[model samples]
Target: MTVTELLDRAHALGSDPRNTNFAGGNASAKGVERDPVTGGDVELMWVKGSGGDLGTLTAEGLAVLRLDRLRAMADTYPGVEREDEMVAAFDFCLHGKGGAAPSIDTAMHGLVDAVHVDHLHPDSGIAIATAQDGPELTARIFGDRVLWVSWRRPGFQLGLDIAALKEANPQAIGCVLGGHGITAWGETSQECQANSLEIIRTAARYIEEHGRPEPFGPVIHEPLDEVARRERAAALFPLVRGLCSTDVRQVGHYTDSPEVLDFLSRAEHPRLAALGTSCPDHFLRTKVAPLVVDLPPEASLEEVTERLRVLHAAYREEYAAYYARHAVESSPAMRGADPAIVLVPGVGMFSFGKDKQTARVAGEFYVNAINVMRGAEAVSVYAPIPESEKFRIEYWELEEAKLRRLPRPKPLAGRVALVTGGGSGIGAATARRLAAEGACVVVADRDLGSAEKVAAELGARAHRPSDVAVAAAVDVTSEEQVVAAVRQAVLAFGGLDLVVNNAGLSLSRALLETTVDDWNLQHDVMARGSFLVSREAARVLLAQDLGGDIVYISSKNAVFAGPNNVAYGAAKADQAHQVRLLAAELGAHGIRVNGVNPDGVVRGSGIFASGWGANRAAVYGVEEEKLGEFYAQRTLLKREVLPEHIAAAVFALTGGDLSLTTGLHIPVDAGVAAAFLR
Candidate 1:
């Protein structure tokens, strides 16, 4: 098949999570390419590169290597002890710069002799791979079609062993790398994909037919109902997230799928989880093991939290011991003692990472582990690779080098932020800035569609990893909505680190024109709403003990008594006080509350377009279009204020530079002397 066709095939196979997980597999096709210098057809192979996920892989994600050169290296092989050196050797053999760096599995693809190859970590396939009697199971399931090879950590030598077996058994289409995963090869891309599927399906069918029932043992505790489950997660998430962030701040992901809940409820789960995941990909993301709470479903929240604190401390101590036991002097310094995966019997799992996507993927890897355990135990004991072997992979200098290759994180990296009124005006601008600065963002607004658009734009444009931007529909004036929106942040991103209270509206009216309803409505949305949002956010801020930011979007109207703005001005005045009030109360927790007072934001403003601009324009006897210029003329600088300017002020208050500064207001009003704080 052509190289283009091979990529299509790769996309088809990788699209299904059942076939393989995020970045858990590799695929390659051997073809003839015209050499740049000689202008002669040369045999070359294109394989998925290091750290590229097959599902989203592009031509650029493939490594191109000349077959002759790659094959020549085996003759000078330094053997298994120096097998890692072979990875460096592959660069000299590249057909070009190659699209991306060759992955560790490059040798396996190049040396296997087949025209096409697929190395996958399918859950069902790994179930057979990790089974205690994996060889016998492989023989029983696919007979001669699939061969079984004993586990060897992946590198140049494992490729040689697989190639040697393929040479000896010409009838074998593939081999299962015991305690690893599966591999298959064919003369063409289509044949290779089919053979891979054949093995996965046949093994899955074998387990389905012969596997024992209730393989994980009967449920030891029933799962909590959905409502209670979420409540518990909400209550405990900040606490758990805070513990994890002591070393490095992290975002979080919560999963309560039926299978996960069922697995957690089973009696055998803790024992199997403690043994840890078998796949290197799984173990690396989930860590050596998870922290499984010993408490049952019936425990009170207070009781459970108290016990969890002890368990967390114990987990760290045990993790430190594990590191010390396995690490040599040259090993990469301990990454962290925090457990990526956390399991509560009644609840499900909470996975954490430096960003939202990492936490989510880590949880997915653990789920794959659970599936592998289920399939393995159905037939025999679930046996993972030795801890020493896992340690080798975890602390390998190659892996450390990969980490060092990553681009440096932006200033707000690892922080989670929620922006109210993010649909338009200052809120949207602030959301974009924070995301660009590397924060995982949540755009909340009364207009769900508007929030989603801003969220989508920010999510796409921001490339720094570990982020997952989302949108939530919230009317900040409603306490229920406010609480729910804050909870959504905690659940989506582990915890909240920054809050921008930017949801607002204004109406200009004389005392006679302003009704009681106008006064209360404005007050409800700004004054009371700010209080509600701050109170709810403080719970998480205090729970995390991570210190946070709460930036208020007040107005110059709060300080300058403008004509026909009595209701709107008074409400903003109330919001202004909340910044100082909350700062005084939350300072001990490291949360800095601040405000940005802008004179007038005309362009791209939801409030202005919704008639506040025309109302104020009439009050000043100026055309609506000239109102912005009119305000600018009145200011000392004669320049109009903008959303971005206000947003920058918000960032300056909390973006690390102002860590020691709080209970302060920054004026973003193009020099409005009358509104200056005195």
Candidate 2:
């Protein structure tokens, strides 16, 4: 089969989460290609390369190696002790320029005698693979056709072992790699795929047939209803995330999926979860084991939080000990003492990583682990690879090398942001800019549809395009709505780090013409709105104990004394001073509060466009359309400020460059000398 068909096959297998976790599987095909050097045909193998997900495999992600050279190198094999060197040797076996770095699994697919090969970590197959009696169980389930290969760390030696087993068991279509996953081979890509599916299906059926009821024991703690479970998760995430981030900042993901809730509520959860995940892929992402905190479903938030604080510290100490116990001089420095996965019996799972996609995927992998443990316990006692071996894999030099290959993090990589009024104007611009710098963004606005559109666009540009941004609806004036919006941000990406209070409304009226309703509406939307948003977010920020940011999109009228703008100007002045007041009160907590005063954010501003533009233009004796130019010409710099300009100023206020500069106001009015802070 052609290499194109191989990629199609790889995508099919990876697309099914049942077959593998994210980036977990590898596939290959042996084929003939024309050699430019000899002007003749040569044998080559195309396999999925390092750091590539099978679901999204592309031509560029395939490593092409010459079979003759790869086979020849086997003769000089330095055995298992120097198997790491064999990974480097694959570089030499590369054909021509080589498409991508060959993964360690390259040997497993390459050395096999079959023309087509697949090495997958399907949940059902891994359930049997990691079972206590995996070898005997394999014989019972698939009989002799599925050979059982004992556990061996993945390397060139393991590849050779599989190849030797295949040669001896001539009739076997595939093998179950003990304490790991599954592998299958065939003469064609379709046949290989079929054999892989058959093994997975048969193993799954066998487990179902022979499994006992209540494999995890009866549920001792039933999950809370959906809303209450989410509320508990939301309440606990920031504190837990903060604990995880003591050494390094982390992005978090929360999931209350049925499988997760089911697993957490079972009686055997603590025992099985503590035993840890079996597959290296799952273990690598989830760490050695999860941190489980069990409390009654009706427990008070205060009690639950207090319990978490105690447990979190113990978890860190234990994790540090785990690192100390197994580390060698050559092992990579301990990555962190933080647990990747945290389980609350009534809630669901909270997973942490360096970014949103990583965090989300990490949690998803643990769900796969849960499934693995359940399946294994159904028929056989759950048995993972030993702790020492897990330590070796966790700190492997090769994995460290892969990590080093990643680009350095962006300035706001792990920070979370909530941009109010993000559907349009400065808020939207700020959301885009922050997301571009790697912050997880919550685009919140009164217009749900508009917010959703912005979030969709933001996610498309993100590294993994999954959880980088989300939309939330908020009127800001309503305390309930504001709190919910902030909670949405916390539930989405752990907790808050940046908040832009930009939602506002205005009406330009002379003192005599303005009604109290006009005054109250403007004040309620801008002044009271900013206060509620700030107050609710502050709860999470204080809980995190990590420094955070609060930016107010105040107006130049706060200091400019603009005409026929009494209500609007008064509200702006209130917002501007709130920045100073909050900064002073919160400085000890490291919560920096700042304001941006823009005179002419007229072009794209929602406040300006909704009739406020025409009234203000009338007051100044200029046409509404030319108001931006009029305002610009009035400025000392004679420049027109756009939404992007305001966004940049917002970024400057909290974007590390001005970390120590709080209780400050930066104008984005293209140099409005009259609106100087002093």
Candidate 3:
């Protein structure tokens, strides 16, 4: 391949949806065999190896190596990466060897003998391959130009397929491996790279042109009743496990995808089976369609079972046909029992895989695909790849193997979090930090402007103005308001996974001067509000069956009682107790509850300032400035505790990053909570 061709391929691969987010695929090319300086075959194949993002591949990422040696090593080792390592370790193969380890596809590339080879995981390609008609579509587009191999676990089989294809069409430009990705090889590295890019780019464009339209109707609905929910989950789990023969994650990744949300939210879910999975590779993990169990309220167990049997039979037939059309041979080894479609009574659909991870991936794919199909149906009629075509690619041995490989940076992605009082100060800061770390944040505050501002700054999708104190205003003190807020959050973002209850109020007064009204007023906002919110949050968290995190915003006064601020201190102390009680209650449900006792956060302005200011002056007979200075001086760091610092403490607790730290209070007062001397 020429340099120009290589550049073009790189650009096209980056643009292609099939290769979208390709973080660890490779591309390479080689010349005809020639005499080496040492009088041996000196054929050089340029291959992309580890740590290369196909979306942004450059010439430097491609490594040049001896094709014969690479192929020979593949014969010894079952996979390309292992073979490449063997060659790298030997001095005899050091002539054109780069220091970098070759891609897992290096051995496959050598076997193909094509001058150029390119591989990528384009979003569009995955979309097409994931369709029910993936095999037929593949044939329709590439036909004889590209060989469509059944999904196979990558490594030895991949190399074998390339070797077979090369023998049949010695000059074939490239081959599209169902489910996994595509590989292209030409007379030169550049040509092969260009061909590979063109294949995926063209495939992606074709998919986009024929892709499903936007969904036309509402997607979310009120959750099922407790009895119904438990029954549905229990019934669906076994059915899904049987179908995919994998441990199901029960709750799939669809909760995060917009398309899934739309599809699941629809009043009447139609053409669900045709949606397939999100990506072709996911098929090995999750079967094509989730079982839809739309049981009427009056339906009996027998009726539900009959309906499930009918659906199961239909699914099996479709799966068989899909495989027959796409599979090269009728006797291909099956991964497990015939894939089963889980029937989720009243709840929606889910795909099954061999493990929880795979099930979740497949479920996510199906949800997105369904949404897309619904959208397209709205625009016109949805026409996803037929079941037969999808089956072939999904069951392809090589593609199924790719499902075993996992992605990096787990733990935080797609998780939902709510940050109360998040419009400004510590709440706002915590929201931003959680968002940056991958959790979807719901910013709630009494000030709509403040809430919206934080949401806008963080680019969060959920923002609501909620007063956390008043049973009527914030209603954090009211079970009704608290329930409503939580429900709204879940409805808006799909689920509630984290909660940062950083909303409260404080008042200062000398014990002798403090009235009964003052004590009640302070207690109402801080103590009562915290209790109400925590109680409501616990209920919702338990219902979701998604273990959650709660971090209450207590003050150091809860521990180190401040002078003349008896009311505020008393309320804070109660708040701390609430955290412990909530934690103890919710622990069985996997919900972790904790508290942050910030001594003095100088950065939170407005009501916080007034409350703290009033207390500081009244207690110490000092100005606000002097009190702040004194507080700072008392800290080991001698630094003012900014709202951000306090927010950070809250974030750590609620993030689940500190899983075992529930019922504990972290002081973010710049060490003032620890210092005894004033």
Candidate 4:
């Protein structure tokens, strides 16, 4: 297959949760390339790069290696494995346009004598692969179609062993790597993929026949139960969240997928859940073992808190002991193991990370690992790589290097934010700024498409693109919608840390000319909308017991009213008043309420897009072309206020500088003396 076609198939395999999780596996294809130096057809292998996901694999993501050079490098490592030296040699074998770090399994792929090779951690297949009697079972299940290789650390030695097995059993289509995963190969990509899928299905059927006593179906639940679960989440989430916090500021995420539910609901859950990962690659995300926090459904809030405290203390001690055991052999002394997966007896799994998407990635892999182990326990036993081997994988310098490649966490890395009217104007700019600083933002607007576009743009640039931003359709005036939006944000990102209330409308008419509709829309969106958003956001922040920021986008007209803009000015005045009252009310809880009063932001703003500036220009007896210059000349700074300027001011208030200040309005209009703080 062409490289593009191979990537497409690889993505199809990796994206399926049943097949692989958290970029756990890689694939490669052998192709002939014309050597630029000698017009000769030289054999090259293109393997998946180290840090890129198969789900988003591109041609550029594949690391190209000259097959012969890689094998020659392998020949030099004849005895005790030096992982570091071996990796350097692999890097040295890069052929053409091949600087990307090849997958750690590249040598094995190059050694396989097939045009196409695929390695996967399919849950069903791994369940059997990690079983204690995996070798015997392999003979019984595939009956010599596959060879069985005993547990070996992945490095130069493992590559050599795999090649030896292939040489001895030339007719075998694939091999089951005991205590690790599955490797399949064929002359074509389709044949290799089909071989892997058939093995996975056959193993799954075998597991079902031998392991489970009863057939399993999806867990049934009523609509009200889900509502109750969310309610419980609001009330008790903080207790567990507090236990998981590495410090006072960082927040963690909770995952409650159907797969998690199934695994946590198993009969021997506590024993099975505490076991190690299905393979070493999984340890990168889930740690060696999970931390179990058994919160019974009937437990009271006080009981829940006490149980979590006790469990957290014990989990920490166990992690310390595990590290101590391995630290002596680890080249660099190991760091303390932080809990990755937390299992709640009655609830589903909750995975912790520095941010939301990191947590999601860890959670997905852990859930898959749990399913695989359960399948193995049913038939025989889930005997994954032993503790010593798992330690090597966890502390390996080459593997740890990947974590260092990520940018340092921003101040708002673990925080969640909500931006009303975020599809356009200052709201959109503010959402982007917050997302850039590492906050998971919700872009909420009446325009779903615009909101989605804004969210998509932010997500595309984020480190964890999938979880950085989400779009929500909200009419801020409706109490139900406002409350629902807050709940959704909490459910999606675990909790709320900041809220920007920016949705508003304008009515360019005097009180006498204004209809009730005009007055109501302006007041409802500006005055009432800000109130609703602030109230709901406060509710979540208070429940979280974490200090947060609530900012309102008001108008300078509140202090300096325009001749025809009565409704808008009066409503903004009321909105500013709401900020003060909210600040006074929520200050004790450390929830800061503030406002940014901006005027004449004509560029890239909804107010200008909707022609509000043209109407105002007519009243001022100036052309629309001169309106920007007029506002610029009017400000003491002699510069027109841009949406980004307003957005920067909003971020300033939410940031550390004004952490002690609240209930104040900062103007963004070129100094309007009349609108200045008295």
Candidate 5:
């Protein structure tokens, strides 16, 4: 088969989430190439490179190596202890692209005689592959269809083992790597793909017939409303993350879907999950097992927090003991990382990572592992790769290299910010700026699509490896939605540190022409909305017991009145007053509340984008396009107040230099005397 066709088949195999996750699994195809110097046909093998996702595999992501060279290197390869030498050998034998690093398993792929080879960590296959009785059980089911390779730390030794196994049984279709995954091969790409799927599907069907009976998994508890669920998630995630962080800052991601809640509901969840990962590959991302926290249904938030600390301490103690038992006197002490997964009995599970994306990936793999464990236990006893094997994999130098490659985090790392009306204007600009500074941001807006778009944009630019941008549809005026937004921020990024109350609506009609609806709408969003959001946000900040900043996007209309703008101006005036009162009350909790009053920000703002500028310009008998210039020329500094300018002022108020400043207004208007703070 052609190289393009093999990649297409590889992408097809990875498309199934059940087969492999993002940036996981590898594949290869064998083809002949013309030697540049000799102009003679030479055998070569193309394998997926490091960091390449099989779901989106391309020719560029494949590393082509001379088949004869690879086999020759393997024949005289150094032992597993010499990982550096092994890597150098692979690098020196590149026949295709020279820059990309091939998968560490390329040696094994080279040893196999098949023209097309694929490796995957499919959950079903892993369920059997990682079982203690996996070899015996696999032989019983697949019989001679597949061979079972015992668990060994993935490296040159494992490759040698594969080569030995193939040499012994050249007719074997494929082999299940004990406590790891599976390999399938054929003379054609289609044959390889079909063989892999057949193995996975057969294993799944066997589990159905012989595995554990139904109803063993937990049941979904009575459903909680969106707001209630988010509230609890917000309050508990921070405590869990704090405990998992071990003096370092860690971002957390939580999941409480009905399926997950049901899984946690099982009485034997802790023991069942503690059996270890469904496959050895998951150990790198999820660690060995989850840290289970017991929370009775009647426990209060304070009680839960205290219980989590105690349980987390116990987990750490156990991990230390485990490491001590495994280490040799000559080996450097392996630093123990926090348990990647946290199980809250009667609640759900939480996952921790340096950033949100890593946390999510950990959570996803943990969930899959749980499912596999349940299925395996039903048919037979669930047994994972031995602790000795897992310890070796966890401390492997090659696995640790992935973490070392990550870029250093930027400033503001571990902080969480919520930006209201973040879909556009100063709010969106502020969200992007905060994300760039290494803060995880929650983009909350009245429009869900807009918020999601902004979140997607910002997430793409995150400076921290695990930092994330999340979106929430929220109406600041609605108490339920406002509280939920605060909870969303907390649940997404551990806790809230910065809140920007920037959502507003304007009524530009004269008093004689204004209706009650115009007056109430303006006040509901600008005055009442800011009040609700600030109150809820302050509640979360206080619960976290961490100092935080709340900045309101008040208007210059609050200080300087404009004709036919009674509703908007009066509401903004009331908002500015509320900020002072909030500061007075929240200051004792180390929460700073301030306001930014921006004047004549006619361009790149949501207020004007929604037709407000056209209406205001018509009232002044000027073209809408010229209003920005008009406002700029009218200012003392003769400069337009851009959204970014307002964003900078908001940043200043929340930053360290303004640590002692509160109960104040910072104007973004360019030297407008009337708009200046009193």
Candidate 6:
């Protein structure tokens, strides 16, 4: 088409409601298409793909590609990658259809060969056309420069029309159909873009001046008490469905705000006919403008019917006209014949949809739009895309296609864990296992050097020393400390999804021999320390809204209080109780708390001191070897439990994919505690 013809068509199309399909039409190119003016092969074209708002077309939405290769690749790769891949393969996919996968509209673009194509649904265009002034307005805008075609269903027929137009006017920039978006092309990509923008801007301006919106008077609704409102919200599904005559199963009711009340209460509810969404795609969620009403509490079913009749009639009339103007003879009947609408009582509006999910999504969007409109009112005008324009983009096939793309990931593509006693033994073992399972670990211990060494061995997946017993050391213990540590962990490794509270201490003493100082020291390091660390861990888990596992290193002493271990046994028993308490308190917050009680853990564990070896030997009236053998023989497993065994228990508790068992105290004592009668 000639440049002037294209420009005229763009202008006409910009004002046509049917021209814009759901989700808006997108026009893109790859390789070089000859420019009408410059006759140069520099490749460029504007694509309507990125902008989320169908009503407004911005430069950012336009995806530019090499023209020659884009068309050819599309013909070649029918079912290849979608958007990004198509763009990436553009350079190599030249010539005939090779191994490339092209966009669905590749054939259409190749057929039109237009430098610039614009698509949108203009609501005012549809609203005005219910009568005859619509065509008259078209004539006034284009004069002789534009070629107008009768409305046709998009796809083959539309493509044919463009082909004919191109044949008729070799220098034509673009074309416009009665009920569709406009198309404009020029020798340069910029010119085509500018032409499209100018046409739409001009049409918007005309609508603002000629099609003035009616004023709505302030509506007054009965004030509702907070208790009543909350009760109403609790039964929101039934209430909202009753209001809008649609499902509300998935819909959530927000507390009624002043804006919602005011919007719902307007006396002269402005007709949405002129501001319908641009296309049918939007109808998937937003059926149509919500029906605004003010019904009395005593209103009868008949009264409600009468109000609905008025609103439905208006909507049906507008919809019929739109269909008649745009639908092809072969097109199927529109489903859900009635457009969705909102119903407002004395205050607040409810959105309607075919299903609950749709209704809820539409309601949320409506609320957001209301907020935006209210904010805009404070600054300037609260202008939204015409309803028809919104409809067109909502229904656009290309726009819908774009939404199917998945998101990408980051470099640290793994889980993260925090180990409380990661400085050595069971804590260190657990940290190492977590790292092996593709997790970055934060090793915290009272011994800073030990923590650093463990962290170094684990490479980049470890944390420094953190004392679980000290209030200030294990930040998870103190609110401030926990907040800081959690924040640091999140900042460093992105997030903390696991915590192993294995930091603890034990002292062996007879009941009478256990002094107050000894009891306090053991309690502080074991029971209090676990409490502090677990508290911090709970805080982090709650803050992140993550359900995490916490494994406390308790002991078999928790169940069997042995002689010469009064202080240690008591502390361990208290630790088990703490776990249960934490589990109960944090269950609602998705935090799982549990404990591991193990006995006879040899192999360099602090539980077995050099002095204990000799002391136990003396008690048994046997040598060290004999005492060790006797201790081992007492267990059902008939084996000495090692530090690694305890580590394994720690691993089982914190690991994901395990059963969600909280407040549990699993014995890792080889059944020895059961053998010893209390």
lDDT by residue (tens digit), candidate 4, 294-412: 65555676786678778878988888787778766545555554577777655666676778767787887787787777777777877788787787778878777766777777867
| TM-score per candidate, chains pooled | 0.97, 0.98, 0.60, 0.88, 0.86, 0.40
- Cα deviation of 512, candidate 5, in Å: 8.0
Instruction: Quote the positional error of residue 88 for candidate 2 in Å.
Output: 1.7
The collision pairs in model 5 are 211-378, 211-379, 212-378, 212-379, 355-466, 356-466
- lDDT per residue as tens, model 5, 1-678: 578887898889988977777667788888887898899999988899887878877788889888888888766776666754686688767885453577678877887778888888888888788666888988987888788998776666777777677668877778888877888888888888888888888888888888756434544344345566566667787667667777565678788866567667666666777776847557777888888766654467788788878878888888887787787764445666578888775567788777777777788788778767766676766778778777776765666675577678776677788999999988889888888777788999999999999889986643333357889999987999997787777777777788898998776898899999999998999899988988887776776666788998998899897899999999999989988998999899888989999987888788987888988898988899999988898889999889889888877886567899988898888988877776
lDDT of 6 by residue, 251-368 (tens): 2223256655555555433443224332233444555455554464234545654665576566667666765655555434454334454544543444543322334345544543
Query: What tens-digit string does per-residue lDDT give for candidate 1 at 230-321?
Result: 99999999999998777898888999988799998998988998999988889989998999999998899998899889999999999999
Clashes of each: 2, 0, 45, 0, 6, 62
Candidates' lDDT values, in order? 0.90, 0.90, 0.59, 0.79, 0.79, 0.52
Please give the lDDT score at residue 68 for candidate 5.
Answer: 88
Model 1 backbone overlap count: 2
What's the C-alpha lDDT at position 415 in model 6? 41
Scored against the true structure, residue 163 in model 4 reaches a CA lDDT of 80
User: Residue 368's C-alpha lDDT in candidate 1?
Assistant: 91
Better of 1 and 3 by lDDT: 1
* Candidate 4 or 3, higher lDDT: 4
Could you give the C-alpha RMSD of every candidate to the true structure, in order shown?
Answer: 1.7, 1.5, 9.6, 3.6, 4.0, 14.4
lDDT of 3: 0.59
Residue range 1-678, candidate 2, lDDT tens digits: 478889999989999998887889899999999999999999999999998898989889999999998888789998789889888888988997849899989999999999999999988999999999998899999989999998888989999999999999989999999888999999988999999899989988988899987889998878899888888888899999999898899999999999998988888999998898878898889898998886777788999899888888998899889899998788888888888999988888999999988899999999988888889999999999999989888898988888898999999999999999999988899999999888999999999999999899999855465588999999988999999999899999999999999998889899999999999999999999999999999999999989899999998989989788899999999999999999999999999999999877888888888999999889889999999999889888898989999889888887799889899988878777778878
